[model samples]
Target: MPDFQKIPSNDVIDTLLKRVSVRKFTDEQISDETLDLILKTSFRAPTSSNIQAYSVVVVRDQEKLDALAAASGGQRHVAQAPVFLAFCADISRIEDALVRNGHSIDSNNLETGLVSAIDAALVGMSAYLVADSLGIKGVMIGGARNKPHEVAHILGLPQRVFCVFGMSLGWPAEAPAQKPRMDYDGLVHFEQYGKSRSGADAKKVVDDYDVALAEHYRGQGRQTTDASWSDDMDKKFHPWLRDDLRERLKELGFDFR
Candidate 1:
């Protein structure tokens, strides 16, 4: 039998365990050499069929960062961070390469979009992990998608490309308490979803989590409700947040139709 307890700890493992989203940072900027090393190392992450259908736009200009901050719904962290990395799902390069071979991405479909987005997500995560290991902390800005069209315009991205997400990186000035996560059994399943994994089972997990999260909020001197997590999720997800996203993505040349 394998002895899981005997597994030795390593730097990467420690980094993963200690990972937290950092929004505030000191005045220090990430050195160009260090940024290059992080990006190059992260690009080594697995790509689908080696297509490498992703691109990263490094923004250091205060004006552009400010524009991006507005594009992402006025996220001050985006504007304040020393660097903002926009990880993009880009098919334009692939299309260009295909044209050289007498073909084009004319038949792009949902699968194609999904593959490219997944590729960008993988590389983005790899970059974050690399940065975290080096004591640089940051947060993933999914709000970059809140206004995809504006993001493309700000980044000067071509039609067949979109910012899947953005990341802000810098030296930390504050360490916010790490939030608790959902129960493991609720998220991880063996063989298949458990036989009792129905609405009640799921709700039980969430219900327990609600109480735990309420306590967590109280500990942080923040207000909380009885159903803290669920209430917040409902508030954010209700009314179908970002109703214009599908059309915006279509305008950006992502074919989900």
Candidate 2:
């Protein structure tokens, strides 16, 4: 087995290791200077081929925040947080640049969409990490995609641009316990997928995690079944989610080819 003791430890590593999503926040707003620092520093995150196909819309207006909260399936944190940052996967500027250089975005396909989304994700995580390191707490809102068209309209997004996700940032009012994660063997592979592990072994890993997660919830005064993770995931995703996402994204200029 690899020597896990060789892993380096640092402030960033410790912060990430204990990271938990923060949904409740104090009334205090993030200052413009700090917000600017977070954004500028986060934009430094690596992008594919330096395409930088992303943009962030900072929303502080109460009316717009309420609308965005509704758009995000009634996530109150989206509105209550001092600020909401809509991280967009944007190829609009790329299209505009192409036009200026005698080219067009007609050649765009799945890879174009994936690259832009990945770029946005990278920057979003960087922003979250920076904010957390500064003692600010927040949660990533994937619910921003629950109403894609409405989100696009609310944010005045242009063609080829959509909110990949959002983040609500502020000082914390509550600190929820970090939930348990799946076993390392279930997630990490060696030279090959699962290495010598069999499908039965993978299933066992998830089953064990289910019990551990259930215990974690119980400790927090939340009732849960022994198969907490599996049951919750099955109920949440067995039917798949946002079934109309493909059509919606296509209308937004990402057809996934």
Deviation from native of the Cα of residue 188 in model 1, angstroms: 1.3
lDDT scores of the candidates, listed in order: 0.92, 0.92
lDDT per residue, candidate 1, 189-210, as tens digits?
Answer: 6667753344336777899899
- Stretches of candidate 2 off by over 4 Å are 1-8, 196-200
Candidate closest to the true structure, highest TM-score? 1
Clashing pairs in 2: none
TM-score for candidate 1, please give it: 0.94
lDDT of 2: 0.92
List of clashing residue pairs for candidate 1: none
The TM-score of predicted model 2 comes to 0.93
Deviation in Å, model 2, residue 66 alpha carbon: 0.9
